[model samples]
Target: MSGEWQHGLLGCFDNFTLCLISWLVPCYQFGKNAEAVGESCLICGLGFLVPVVDIFLAIHIRGKIRESKGIQGSLIGDLLYWCFCPLCSLVQEAQEVGGAPQAISMGRE
Candidate 1:
């Protein structure tokens, strides 16, 4: 696996609207990232409600995204990323999973 994140964390200005949304409603942004990678939005969203567990869950979701997309990253990196800058991490995942510029559709076809 040798892929990289499509967008940088601090490059939120690339999508100012998403940056605002991410800053305002991080859980919602995280939920969108989770759904994009085929995780349960409700479950992931709920995880963020708890402070301690949210870090672990965020790392788990990031790992899922990395694995699914063949992106290169480590557990420590994920932990640190979520620990220090969760909003940027969420936005990065959203970009990686192609959910940044669009709304996450919950309805099944």
Candidate 2:
């Protein structure tokens, strides 16, 4: 695995649907990202409803993702991303872990 994010923080528009979802329902996107890394989707999704806990959860899950995927990043960077551009960060994480690769089919034909 590459020691880098599959999608850039500002590359949310790379997948318009995911970007829109991340914008329209941030909690859901966050939950999905958390779930991808074995965290409780409902707990994380509901945690996003809170103010302070949301940032903490985001940072925690981002760290889990980075560790699982071998992506290079720091907690401070994760904090900055979640604090400044949460939607973009959510979209990036979703793209990195949620979707199947373009060359493969994850769904039944």
Candidate 3:
């Protein structure tokens, strides 16, 4: 039940609306992504306001997604993605989870 990410990290153009939304309201988008993984949307969303907390949250969520999907990745890679291309990572996770409640339900055991 595990595999690679359905959406590539740089394939932002594949979902233009998602990319735009993630860019415009990152906290909201991050919240959505976190919620998809059964995390607290409000807390994770607000974590963006903190300087380093955001990175930690991003890394943790990315790990969750990778574990759920059986995608191959590392902590350093996740950190780099959050540091260099956070919006992309957000969109990537959102896309990976399909941004729908059903998406996570189907992804879990």
Colliding residue pairs in candidate 3: none
lDDT of 2 by residue, 16-104 (tens): 87788888988888888888899999999999999999999999999999999999989999999989988888888999996422445
Best by lDDT: 2
**lDDT tens digits, residue span 62-90, model 3:** 99989888899899999999899988888
Candidate 2 vs candidate 3, lDDT winner: 2
- Choose 1 or 3, whichever is better by TM-score: 3
**lDDT of candidate 1 vs native?**
0.84
CA displacement after TM-score superposition, residue 102 of candidate 1 (Å)? 3.7
How do all models score by TM-score?
A: 0.85, 0.88, 0.86
After TM-score superposition, what is the CA distance of residue 109 in candidate 3 from its true location, in Å? Answer: 35
For candidate 1, write residues 1-109 as lDDT tens digits: 4588778877777777778887888888888888988888888888888988898889999999999988898999999988888888887787777775566899999
| Least accurate 10 contiguous residues by lDDT in model 1 | 94-103
